[model samples]
Structure formats: C-alpha cells, structure tokens
Target: MAKKKSNVVNLDERKEAKAKASSGNSMMVSIMNMTKRIEELKTEKQKICEMAARTILKALDAKDKYTYGHSMRVTYFSMVLGKELGLNDQEMYDLQLSALFHDIGKIGTPDAVLNKPTRLSDEEFKIMKKHPTESYEILKGFSVFEKVARFAKHHHERYDGRGYPDGLKGEQIPLYSRIILIADTFDAMTSTRVYRKGLPYQTAYDELNEFSGSQFDPELVVKFIRGMKKEQAKKEDKFYIPLMDEMYEKDAA
Candidate 1:
C-alpha cells in the first residue's frame, strides 16, 4: 500500500510539470503573433497614406497641368538640396512631400488668375498670396499630413519677416519650408515658358545671392548654388523623383 501511494504522488508531480511547460510555450506563441500583427497594421497605415497622396496629386493635375509639372520639378530640386544638407531618409521624405504639395492650394485659385500670362495686379496678387493659407486649410484636417501641411503653408515666408500669411522669419521658419522656397524660386526662374526664356543658370544663381538674407536664407542659397553647379557638371539628362516613383528628363523642365 505504501509503495502504491508513492507511485501515485510521482505521477501527479510529472503531470503538473508538463502542464506548466505547455502553458509557457502557448504564451510565447501568443506574444509573437501580437508582434506580427502590430507590424502588419503599421504597413497598412503607410499604404493608406501613400494612396491619399496620389489621389491629391491627381486632383492637382486636373486643375492645372503646368502647376502639376512645376510641383514635380520642385520636389526634385528640393531633394537635391536635401542631399546637400545631409538629411536623413525620413527628413528627405518629408521635404519631398512638402515640396510636391506646396502649391496644392493653387488648385482653388481662379483660373483667370492662375493662367494669366502677364504680371498679376495688386488685387490679383493678394488673391494669389492666399494660396499658402488655403493649403494649410486643406491639409490640416489630415493627421498624417500635419507636418507637411505646415511646411507648405510657410514656404512663401521671407527670411526678413516681410513675407505673406504668418510672416515667420529666419530660423523661426521651418527648415523644410526654407528649402522648398529656394527650390520653388529656382524652378520659376529657370523653367522656360512661351512668353519668356528661362534665365541662364549663372544668372539665376546671381539673383539668389543678391536677395539672400532678405527674400531667402543666405546659407541655403549658398548650398543650393554649390549643389546645382555640381549637378550641372554631371550633365545627367534624366532625374528620378522618389516620391512620385517616376523619372523625368532635364529638358522636359
């Protein structure tokens, strides 16, 4: 009888040990599954954001073809400057989106004012200047675009505090905004149109230098000129914009 009782007790101890081990394994599997699910959700969110961005670009394309192309070129130019500044991957991504959408508010501008070949009158210019704020209004509602929207809204701000809208100045201006401003102005000066020939690269560089510290950030202007000169030396006809996932020829600009 004593031997039989000892045998029963050993069996119970073995069974309890096995049960504890099984429960631990099950808990580990659950934890791994939860981690994988979290990664999948993050990927899904990023895809949704990219889809929304493409849709907005399509709308801008329908509204104005020239502005659409201009936005693309601005994005490319901004990336070049971002590289010169040694920005990280995430920083470059944000700057690219900000530049691409900087003039998105122009979609709401009157066609007459947007396409006018000549200079805008004071009143028309006032309406045109409202585009930055309009960009903010359109983008502020989207949580994913919070920073990009703010950068676009302040792209027109001058370094000397004389610019329109919020009038943010100098270092107070967002760094990405300052970079976009340089790219925007460069594209505008260098892009050829039916009415006027694009300025020579040197001429454009000189203009940027002349207005530095007032209309533009002086350090950025220097960096831009240096980077662009190197880019020109490369003489690469084709350029790729990562955000758009497309390649464009320099001549197309």
Candidate 2:
C-alpha cells in the first residue's frame, strides 16, 4: 500500500511539472504573436497615413494646377538642400512631405486672391498671408502629420523677427521650415509666369543672397545655392519626385 501511494505521488508531481512547462511555452508563443501583430499594425498605420497624404495632394492638384506643380518643385528643391545638409533618411522624408504640403492651405483661398495675375492689394495680401495658418489648421488634425503641420505653418517665418502669424525668429523656427522657406522663395523667383519670365538661376541666387539674414537663413541660403549649383551642373533634363511618382522637366514652366 505504501509503495502504491508513493508511485501515485510521483506521477502527480510529474504531471504538474509538465503542465507548468506547457503553460510557459504557451505564454512565450502569445508574446511572440503580440510582437508580430504590433509590427504589422505599425506598417498598416503608415500605409494609411501615406494614402491620406496622396489623397490630399490630389485634391490640391484639382484645385490649383500651378500650386500642385509648384509643390512638386519645392519638394525637389528642398531635397537638394536636405542632401547638402546631410540629413538622415527620416529627416529627408519629413522634409519632403512638409515642403509638399507647405502651400496646401492655398486651396482654401478665394480664386481672386489665389490666382490673380497682378500684385495683390492690401486686403488681398492679407488674405493670402493666412495660408500658413490655414495649412496648420488643415494638417494638425492628423496624428501622423503633426510635425509636418508645424513645419508648414512656420515656413513663412523669417530669420529676423519680421515674419507673420507668430513671428518665430532665427533658430526658434524649425530647421525644416527654414529650409522650405528658402526653397519656396527660390521656386517663386525662378518659375515662369504669364506676367513675368523666370529669373535666371544665378539671378535668383543673387536675390536669395541679398535677403540672407533678413528674409532668410544665411547658412541655409549658402547651402541651398551650393546644392543647386551642383544640381544645375548635372544637366539632367528631367527630375523625378518619388512621393508623387511623377517626373518634371528641369526647367518646367
């Protein structure tokens, strides 16, 4: 009877140990599954955000063809400076999106103010100046676009404390914003319009240099000019924008 009882106790101990090992293995598998699921969710969220960005860009295209093309050019120009600045991959990505969306708020402006061929009146200029704030409003709602929104909002700020909508000065402005502003002004000066011929690249460079430290960041202006000179030397007829999957001629009008 004693021997039989001991055998029963040993069997119970073995069964308990096996059960514990099985529970531990199950827990490990659950943890691994959760980790994989988390990674997948992150990828899915990124895709959704990208999709949203594309949709908004398309809407801008439909609203203003000129602005759409300008956005593409601005993005290209910003990337040139971004490369010269030795930005990391993620910084480059963020810079591209911020530049592309910087003028997106113009979509909400009245056509008279937005599409006027002549110089704007004070009222019209006031309306036009609201675009950066409008851009912030449009973009700040998205979790993925929070940083991009801030960059867009501050793109109009000057190196001096003279700019509008908050007047953030010098390095107080986001670096990406400062970079985009240079690119924006460059594109505006160099892009051909019905009323005026585009300035030569050198002429535009001179203009940027003239305003350095007053209207623009002095260091960034130098880097932008250097980078752009290299781009011009490439002598490539067409440049491709990866975000929109489109190609633009080097001197697109």
Candidate 3:
C-alpha cells in the first residue's frame, strides 16, 4: 500500500511540472505578441506624421510656386554641405527638414510681395522679413518639427548679429540654421527670377566669399563652396529631395 502511494505521488508531481511549463510558454508567447503590436503601433504613428507633413508641404507649394521650387534646391545644396560635414544619419535627417522648411513662412506672404518683379519697398521688405519667424510659428506647432522650427527661425540670422526677427550671433545660431542660410543665399543667387537673371555659379561663389564672416560663418562657407564644386563635377543637372521623393532641375526653369 505504501509503494502504491509513492507511485501516485510521483505521477501528480509530473503533471504539476508539465502544467507549469505550459503556462510559462503561454506567457512568453503573449509577451512577444505584445511587443510586436507595440512596434506596429509605432510604425503607424510615423506614417501618420509623414502624411501630415506632406499635406502641409502641398499647401506651401500651392501658395507659391517659386518659393516651393527654391526650397527644393536649397534642400539639395544643404545636403551637399551636410554630407561634406560627415553628419550622421539623424543629423542629416534633421538638416534636410530644416532646409526644406526654412522658408515655409512664405505661405503667409502676400502675392504682391512674394512675386513682385521689382525690388521690395522697405515696408514690403519688412513684411517679407517676417517669414522666418512665421516659419517658426508654423512648424513649432508640430511635435516632430521642434528642431526644424528653431533652425528655420534662425536661418536668416547673421554671423554678425544683424539678422531680422532675432539677433542671434555667431554660434548662437543653430548649426543647421547656419548651413541653411548659405544654401538659401546660394539658391537665390543661382536661380533665375522674374526680377533679374541669375548670376553665374562662379560669380555666386565670389559673392559668397565677399560676405563670409559677416553674413555667413567663414568655415561653413568654405565647406559649402567645396561641396558645391564636387556636386557640379558630378555633371548631374538635377537633385533629389527625399521628403518629396522628386528630382528637380539644377537651374531655374
């Protein structure tokens, strides 16, 4: 009878151990499933954010075709400098956003000032100069655009503390902002506008050299010029913007 009891006890112990093992396996599966779901949620959120971003960009495009195209070129030029500076993936991404939206405030600009074929009056210029601050206001409203907004706001800031909206001087300006200003001026110089013919790339380079250390950071100016030369050597007449997923002509059309 004692031997019989021992055999029964061993069988019950085995059953208990098997049940515990099965429960542990079930718990592990549940955890993995939860983790996967969380990752999927994150991807979905990112897609939604991108969709919203594209929508805002389309609105900007509808507001001003010239500014839209100018922004694209600026993005390309900024990326050239960014690559030359060896920015990591995250920095490059942020730089691209900053450059692309640097002039987004122009969406609020009146057609009279934005598309005028003549030089702006001081009053009109004042209205025009409000763009950088306006850009900050628009972009800062989006959670993903924090750095982008700040950089755009400060892009017009001069190294000598003479820029409008803000007097941030030298390195007080975000590095990305400093880079965007160079690209912005470069595009403005190279793009043919209704007001006047575009300057030659060589002439633009000379102009940039003339203002270095006053309007631009001297070191960044050198990097931008060097990067642009390499870009020209590639002999490609078009550049790509990852956000728009589009290629644009190097020269103004």
Query: Candidate order by lDDT, highest to lowest?
Result: 2, 3, 1
Candidate numbers sorted by TM-score from highest down: 2, 1, 3
lDDT for 226 (candidate 1): 88
| Winner by lDDT between candidate 2 and candidate 1 | 2
lDDT of 3 at 174: 93
Q: Tens digit of lDDT per residue, candidate 3, span 124-178?
A: 9999999999989988887778888899999999999999677989999899999
Check candidate 3 and list the clashing pairs. none
> Candidate 1 overall Cα lDDT vs. reference?
0.88
Clashes of each: 0, 0, 0
Residue range with the least summed lDDT across 10 consecutive positions in model 1: 244-253
- TM-scores of the candidates are 0.86, 0.88, 0.85
Report the lDDT tens digits of candidate 2 across residue range 1-253. 9999999999999999999999999999999999999999987886687788678778888887789888889999999999999999999999998999999888789988888999999999999999999988888877778999999999999999799779999999999999999999998999988888899999999999999999999999999999999999998878888877789865647
Q: Cα lDDT of all candidates, in order?
A: 0.88, 0.91, 0.90
Two-way lDDT contest, 2 vs 3, winner: 2
The alpha-carbon deviation from the true structure for residue 194 of candidate 1, after best TM-score superposition, in angstroms, is 1.9
Candidate 2, TM-score vs. the true structure? 0.88
